[model samples]
Target chain A: MSDSPIVNEFNQGPISCHAFNGDRTELAICFNTNVVTIFRKSGASWTQTSTLVEHDKPVTSIDWAPKSNRIVTCSQDRNAYVWTLDGASHQWKPTLVLLRINRAATFVRWSPEEDKFAVASGSRCISVCYFEEDNDWWVGKHIKKPIRSTVLSIDWHPNNVLLAAGCADMKARVFSAFIKGIDKKPAPSPWGEKLPFNTLCGEFSNGAGGWIHGVAFSPSGESLVFTGHDSTITVVSPGTGDIQSIRAPYLPYLSVIWLNENQIVAAGHDCAPHLFERKGQQWAFSASLDAAVKKADVGFTARDTFRRMDSRAQSTTSTDTEVHTHHQNTINSIRSFSGTPEHVEQFSTSAIDGKLILWNADSISRGLGNLHL
Target chain B: MAFRKIDIDALEEDAFGEDEIDFQEIGELRPVADVDAQVNSRAQEVRSLLQRGNTSGALSTSLQNPPYGAPFHAAKARNTQTVMEVLNSIKVSDVPQLVKSLSPEEQDVLMKYLYAGMAAPEQNNSGHLLAWHEKLTEVAGQGCIVRVITDRRTV
Candidate 1:
């Protein structure tokens, strides 16, 4: 509940932010004005790394590659652009532009392997593109049922080359990638026979009452959970085709992430982040974040070492004090939280109010820091 | 005995006198060849009519007094069985409309058969049948009867 300048000002504006990698070293912020700013940590201070100014329309979604070397941003201009940063110069530049989409691009995410990325457009199609090193760009994969209902969210499986896409039609489809041999010719009837390259693994009705807004695969990749316009979370076992749905008290506008195997953190239209734990038969809310700590993790500590002069004793003393740092901004999105023995340092979140907050997982309250926009 | 063998053969021939063989035939009941001829002609006429694409009229005429090789009746029976298999796979919600389209006699037969298939073994025969009938009535509604029939006149 510490009131910082970052939170107080962000309470009045609309912005989107994402922390890159588990350490949250790189932060990307997309503003309402259609500009993206990248920030990196230098010493104890955070500084601007680069500003991406390519999209003519407002940016709808932005995602950092799992490697943190590249960023993908999609916009209403019906285009998705990939931006890569130079490690030596700390400069960011757009390297690839995907064009000729039928509708506005809403969301984009890089796959877990960092070899491919998926983009969801308003035209109800999710296009997955693979990066080719020789060509230095992305090429679209052949997809069946190219035109479906509008896709709301697309997420890649944590362990395999599989993708889960949530659509406006209240259905979620799982797509898996397989490599066909070279010189393979197209079959006369693509739909009649199963192709050798790609496979539609499963199509299930997402029991959430309304449009599917967000979908995420657990780190174990055993189950997939999705939330939608309705205030409910549906968990499906991809292995067994079983569905278990839970109702959340508040409607979630954004997404939910698995904190561990059994715990989940969900944030959205609700001002506070809700932490839920799966019990024997139900999901119970374990904790709620403070209004300012929109997307704070459990660990982070900031330590300052300095020499102080005592006025009464007229003596100088050196003291090292450690303070738990927690993010003090409205968190719009969060990714990756890893715990360690000495310190947990891999949780990051973005704020709409113009702050990119990073927290150490071990001591989130004391180890929090922010990169101002 | 050897000396008497030749005389014994001659005596045996003389002892068995030949009887008179008379060949006399009278007409009793005659088999008719005209019946086979009529059947062959009728079959040819039916074949010609079928080849001319007058299957419905041919079938109608054949149904009045069927030809020797009428195969349409057996094919229709097979079609009914196919429809029943398809209906069995349909969801419960769709079964009522499908059963409604059937004729009243077919509806009755299907209802009885389905009820028998679903009835529990321990239940009384009458009770199970009544319960199944009630359920079918609920699904099929009033004034509707499932019927499956082969109208020989129309065939």
Candidate 2:
């Protein structure tokens, strides 16, 4: 609808999304209905890579393994399914189905170094499973705790030996890996002789009326940053056990990603994405998109169409008052990739308001010469 | 009924029959029974406040508006006497020697508080210099006491 570049648009509707590989060349979009669509970008155009329909419930989370060609998807049915891309048929097929977990899996992450994957269950436990060469998946470890008041978010350490999980209890816990015989002998147990991974560290009180929704570790793995419904962003020194809390004017930061060591990008409940930088001993807001621009970028634009639609929305909003006055859906999530100095790509937000809006960060940084004010 | 002003000097001369007053007689002076009871009750109130983690309020109440004939007056007097005695025992010249006896970790901890002027007064003989020296000794290993004294001269 605008002059912004549209990477791709899906008529089937996308509810959740994840990248297919490290390069983010392919994207997998999960629908509210049972369908999952894979799209690929080719020469400024997006082609439907493949569409798979296997789940009866909405897909809650999707993750791509670091060392394998497999994709993992967990849904409301309380099962995690693994899919592999078949080059010959140009289709994605379910390879391994892990069932009988007895709880809905909300988040899934792949370890950085190994074939191990961490899945957060609704029952307040993180299950660590590893894929074997024989194409079979085995539960390697399980970190269990008391029943949480709500579902928790879990992420793997950047180097893969540690796992960090955030609970409704308002605490973030870290668990480190222990190798049998090399580091310590694994005690024999009924759940398999896997080394007992205990909580090495924990922080904050969920009872303080702030529930930690998401937790992310810096790329260097030296510091941990977390956001909660309390509208507070906390930076914790894992080494010293010191916490520095900064409150955002808007409460409930839904998601956060590390742009680099010193900078963090977050999406707030206000439907705006904010960039923050660690200045001296405190974190300060650097930049934020206006509400109108955020709405236009996330609403009508589809995932691949986001990059192209961004510029057009900006131009139209400047000249047209009606377009500026329109109410749009809130942005739910944002994903940015590192690209060449000339171009940067971001993906899937609220498609109802045109989510797929792309901008050239390098050019924008040089000055808004190309943009119409 | 009107009050009469008596000559206290002449009365002391008649009572003790000495130019110098008897210190023992002065010690025997006591308040009325009701006054003593009231003072003790108020002292208990202050102690309870301190125990309840209201240090700032307790300190303010005791120092700013002490109860008349408060029993805590005697305790405060004794604490001051003890602090004075401890301060009198330390020689200004021995500060460097005392500082040299502390360990490295102890030296760092003590130096941080000394530089910030946060060292406890009672523990440091009530002198800023003495407090800094005492803290330095406590942190630096006793074996490095000599190094502290020599380093103090260079600085």
Candidate 3:
């Protein structure tokens, strides 16, 4: 339980986004560029497998659908491509999606059922795209109403009908992405009854209006939680419209993932993941995944102090430029590394500093418990 | 036959299309200011106006306040076109002077706002955003803005 996480630092600069294969053995990462490189994991190390280059601009997001073995990537080029592997040649093929967005696509996510996916764009709308047999390619249906600004992130419900979108409009909205051709009639849920295409179930914002950065559905799909640029995380239980927003003491979070029904892990500009727990009717922040280690000040001496004073003439004592955390820079994404969304045993976080760190859930909950985290 | 009736309520094919406005052109929707009596709150009031896409309204409000009133927030919106509009309508130094008068803490928050505006390296908005930031930092003094970002405890 005390063992360190597996650290993989790439010298290839920042990773714009990354996704893992169904087996968790291969990784698809964009090196802050248009290219997506796939890496195969061998033991504790990783090896490059393939590079998919189709977009003419930087890729903003990536999602790997496990069941279908398909990789979907959206880029600032106002385009998205679905990559499929050719079994005979072992080459990845790109299929363009007709998003029809005039601006950059900001984020994307695959539906729980993996039959379709949603791409959020700076065009003030979301494009729900899926395969069309008649057209022999993927087609998109736009949901443009009520979104006055860019959407920063999106998540699909377990039922595969409702979608939660966090947009720059300072609101988190739940809209039904029920395509007439790709989906069947969805059953009634807490979100709403008689779900149709483009149905906005509910919209929410924090006490202080802030741009929403991250959103996710609880494992039970009964509640939704989102983080905003104002350094706050809000939870909404649509059943009773119970909203609890926590103004975090730390910096803003860029993304969030439900660890289970009761717990969530969020990370962003703070560069470290923080845990939140729900008990009964109350939601509260519980612990830091990377607990701050107190460094003893035993090495300071008069000679060093005088040397420092003579060098810069400043009284600043600390010289360490890095935060005492696993990630040295802003962590942009946190994805499930092992286990299903219902019960994640481990997860991975990638940062702008080009480092990937994987954490074991059991150890985190156990290790931090002793520290009263 | 020439005056056939039509279903006037039918939805247009491109009703929700984004050709009218690009996403980058949208204004930052920060919280509107409450009608507080304090001068700092009044500064925030001008800012709220910009957040709501009321550039002219912000200028008028700042004018009514007189003396120290400056459209500090309207400049911070960083929409480029909006800021340029306000600048062209007044002295370019007016907003910079107001930003310059902001306390060290206020400058840090303003820098954070600018940093967020430069989000997404691929968005290619850093050049414009950085230009404003450089001017503001110059007024705020060297290393003051960065000290806030690097050490949250400082502010």
Candidate 4:
């Protein structure tokens, strides 16, 4: 395994969304466009295998379920399609999901069990879509009470019944996405005992009230951490009503995922992913995962400097456009590329620069010296 | 086919219906208090602390319970003036020491006051307020400024 971060410069437009298959061989990415392109990993490089072209507008989010080998892509065209590989033709087939929403579908995620998926939309509601065997197509059930604004991001509880949504209204909420026929009566969790659909389990504001950009459940689902546009990461424990908010120094984060029970990785406008860890009882900023080395002032000897000063009438080179960090732009999405929820060995981050970087958590732990993941 | 841009405000009105009252507007509505007695007394207390040369105490006292949720604009203005006076009186070199002495929550409150003071530059000394802003952010990190911006309650 490579200790250094593997940077794949796809050079497609900004990758708005991406997902990896079970063994991390194939990748599904949408380049802020209408089509979803699949790439088969070949050594250090990737070659495009096929494209899923169903959505009329830009695909906003994509989730590839590992166990089921099904890829779900949601788009601003207000539709979601589940793509399955066909054995006979060696091609992928798309099954359209009836979202029943008039506005753009912003985000989508398959539950841990891969039985149902939740699609967050600009219609101020969440559509919990599940496969209906009798109808032979996926159907959606709307969860639409008390959500005042567009739902930005949603995460599934480990139990697959409770859904946590971060909204544009600056509220992070927990609601029951429990479907009668599709879901089994979930075991009692801190959220609630009742298994009814659209039950408002909990509602929270990140103290100062910035739009919640990203939300994620802890490995155990006992706690939820959300990043807000106010540059604050707030952790909520519904069982204890314990909420801890940390204001980060960097620009607001757009996406966050738990590396393990105690460690969380979040990235956004700062163009670097930061690690936040739960120390003792409080969660605090640990370190930046991007160990960006300052660019050395190379080839600027005294003679060269004098020659350049005489010619250009400038003391320093002002045209160096490269940012020292690996990802040249905002990293919008981060996911566990390998390992279990309890211990994510490696994780991947995709940025607006159209570069996908796979980072080794173990190497980061070693690099930090004192921080042990 | 030519597509027309959807008016999000109109779309929201259609989805939720025009009769629905905005909860935020309702939250802002409250019975106006007639007297500015509490605000006046607090400002007086802060002024006395400043007169005693207890700059930290004056700073803390001024930050405590800034007037809000009322139509007491004059009282709020008076309190802001008093707070600005306390801030301006502090020595620039002594800022880091004063900031270090403040608790985490107190530091956040100071940041809010710093931002509030900077808003009215003509009344408050921008140089002094900017120095305090530097010290506050140094101790509280940028999150304090964010907290102040996001917090609906104002000084």
Candidate 5:
């Protein structure tokens, strides 16, 4: 089923970032390299379609605007490019946007409206870029107050006027990106009523002295969830200032998302996505979506011990080399594979292991119990 | 079924107009820091520092405020048995750094614990100690814990 989560293992090398197109039939990924490769889906397998070779440095992040069918990528070389599929040549054409950040541009995201995008950079600023009609080029306006370190991740509010950033400075902040030139004055949201650009609306620390790795706005844009290097997932409700956090028992997760309003899935160094949900008042770990079933026992014998000792000069009872998870390396990015963010039918995860795994949301919820949906 | 690929043809006929980012603050600025969040070590803050290539920072942290639980907590407890128990869990990949990063006095103390652990009665937990011993031997040839043991012997 297209909605079933499947593990696509193409050892292109550790992937730095990846993006799937609107129909979930194509993918744009950087294989920890300067080039961005596009792949097309056949019935079950993906075939390489085209490669966009432009960035002088490794591409850091990529986002595909589903409605607009445009791909924007940022790289460590301090540049961001918007790629369009040329109708004439059937090739992706690149347009460089003026990010104006001196340090590496670390991450990029398209606003929900698709008319604008935000680029997070190592220079401690979020550059919100939009098409300038008179200038005929993408020009960026900088959000520079209060950000102290590299902006690691940014998410656009559903309203398309608010932006949230997770930075290396151990803080996640929400800012208004309402540019007067493009956006109609946005109506008041729970985050705040002020519609001015670069206004720091809400800011919260990741709560464990770790760099914020990822931040995502809840579908309603009322709550913010972020993963931290401290192996924590913290949720904030901007209206009440009520915060809920759960410290994971495994390695820190780099990415996090709300599966629905009640459930959130986060994954990173643990190499597996974990489920968290609120029950009444408190948030708690529910179950591991990628829990590896135990293998049949291969009875311990003298031959196994001798072989193990001969190889490493040590005799241990067990030599289980594999981590008991599906992903062999850190899962970096987790995006909705199928269905909407409000009710994700399937979700896809890409990792440093150069593997893209698509997971069915219902099946995962089934493993835990039943989903309200 | 194979789905449609995304391209310019997939886009709408009319393009959305864009605007320059207005840097001026147009709305009320909320004091965000007042929201409750912290950087407590319960989230493996020390490991985060170590992974970020802040080894010196990690070392100082461990020396200054070692964790009170698993890996660090045992070492933080500062008892010879607890230290050895923590040291025994070190992977071979981290053995060199574990050995190299500690102060000379700390290293000497760790070696003392290792020597003591070597003499402990072999049991189910003995495998890790032996593993650490073997790894230390490989990383430090003659200058490893053996040298410390011998130097103490001569003294």
Candidate 6:
């Protein structure tokens, strides 16, 4: 239980986003640059397999459809590309998506069915794109009515017809992304019935009014949770109209993922992921995944103490520059790496410090007894 | 008579869609209570507690149910003033003890007041606020400052 997480350093740059293939053998990551690199796992280490370079600007997000074996990448260039493996050429091919957005595209996610995908942009709109067979190209339908600011993050409901977006305007909204021919009429749920395209089923904010940084739905798609810049995570159940907000004693979280129906892991500027659990109708901060250790317990010696006193006027041996957490800088993104949505066995995080870490649920659950992950 | 074909894209480009106003739901949806009277009474109680040298009690009193909603800006301001006065009255040496006695929620509220006091240096003593700020951060860590800066609810 005291073992450290698996740490990998892709020294190219900070990984802005990353996605894994169905078998977790391949990884597609954007190194905060215009290029997206694909890495294939060779034993314990990963080696670069290829680079997809279509965007003229820094790529912001990347997502791989596990079932379809396709990758979608969106960038600040206001464009998105879907990459498919060409069997004859034995190379990855890029297909452009007509986003038609004037501003940078920030985030992208494939729907549950992988038949369509949504791209969130700084243009204050979301482009729900689908393949058009007649034109032999992809076309996008815009959801532009209610969003007043840039959308920061987005999540898809399991039903594949609903999209949840977190915006800089400090609101999280649930909208129907139901396309006429691509999606069937979704069954009635707690969100709403008679689902039409761009139908806003719900809107919410963390009462303190911080910009929403991340949003996610429960495994069953019955509950939604969003992390706000105000250092709070809010959970809402549209069925009961119950909204529960819990503010943790940590820095704001930029990303959140559900480990199970009742458990959530969120990480961001704090540089470590924290766990939140639901007990009955209430949700509260349960534990910090990266448990804090006493600094004096390790690496503080008499020589270091004298050196610290010699360098600075301080008499203490504490290192002021280094954080005690696993991640040295802000964690920009977190994704479920393994297990079912009902119980994610492992998860991964990428940070500004050019490190990608994989955390195991078994070790964490063992360390913190009574936790079910 | 031949009818002209309507291009949906062209119509969307020329026509204006209904703009949705993003209002803070906390302020408008929650009905305004008698916040002015409550804040005034709390201020008086906090002042009395400070005079009696009960800094911990004064802090709890000042932080309890801070007046929110847009309708009671005056009360919020007055409460901020009262909190600043209480903060200034505490001795520098007693800051650690006072901060440690506060719960996490109280510490967050105190942080909001510390920032508010620092914002208006003319109204509050900067040295006293800085002393309190250092102690609070030591007890609560950097998250308190982040919350104070990002949270929309002001003192």
TM-score against truth, every candidate: 0.54, 0.56, 0.70, 0.89, 0.70, 0.87
CAPRI tier for the interface of model 4: acceptable
Model 6: per-residue Cα lDDT over A1-373, one tens digit each = 2247888898988889999999999998888999999999998789998999999999999999999999999999999999999999879999999999999999999998999999999999999999999999999999987897889999999999999999988889999999999999899999999899999999898766677999999999999999998888999998888998886878899999999887899999988899898788789998889876546645478787787788786777556766888888999999999889888889999999888899997667667765664
Q: Score the docking of each candidate (DockQ).
A: 0.00, 0.01, 0.03, 0.37, 0.03, 0.33
Sort order, DockQ high to low? 4, 6, 3, 5, 2, 1
| Model 6 pairs whose backbones collide | none
The recovered share of true contacts, given per candidate in order, is 0.00, 0.00, 0.00, 0.40, 0.00, 0.58
Q: Model 4: per-residue lDDT, tens digit, B36-150?
A: 6766788789889888999989888877766654465776777778778888888999889988888766777778777777888777788888888887788877667776776
lDDT tens per residue, model 3, A1-373: 3356777998898987899988899999998999989999987789998899999999999999998999999999999999999999999999999999999999988998898999999999999998999889999999998898899999999889899999986789999999886788888998999888888999887644457889999888999999887677899998887999875656788889988877889999878888988767788888888866656654378877777788868556775753788788999999888877778878899999899989787676666562112
Candidate 5 local Cα displacement, residue B132, angstroms = 19
TM-score of predicted chain B versus true chain B for each candidate? 0.27, 0.26, 0.37, 0.76, 0.38, 0.78
**lDDT (10s digit) by residue, model 5, range B34-139:** 1111113422544666568765454434333212222232332233343443454445567776766665434434444556566665622566666656655554
Better-scoring candidate (DockQ), 2 or 6: 6
lDDT per residue for candidate 2 within B1-155, as digits (tens), equals 03747645464332322211222112233455544455455556656765685543433333322222233455433332332332234455544554455333334323333432323455444465455445444544332333222121110
Clashing pairs in 3: none
On the 0 to 100 scale, the lDDT of residue A91 in model 6 is 94
Q: For model 3, what is the alpha-carbon lDDT of residue A261?
A: 78
Query: Chain A TM-score for model 5, please?
Result: 0.94
Q: Model 3's DockQ?
A: 0.03
The positional error of residue A172 in candidate 1, measured at the CA in angstroms, is 2.3
State the C-alpha RMSD over the true interface residues for candidate 3, after superposing those residues: 11.2
Worst 10 residues of 2 chain A by lDDT: A364-373
User: Candidate 4 lDDT (Cα, whole model)?
Assistant: 0.86
Global lDDT scores for all candidate models = 0.53, 0.52, 0.76, 0.86, 0.75, 0.87
Query: Largest lDDT belongs to which candidate?
Result: 6
Give a tens-digit lDDT track for model 6, residues B1-155: 13747644464453322122223534443344577778888888998888898888997888888875556778878989888878777789988998898887789889988887888888788888988888888888876787777765656
Stretches of candidate 4 exceeding 4 Å from the true structure: A299-323, A366-373, B1-35, B68-72, B103-105, B148-151
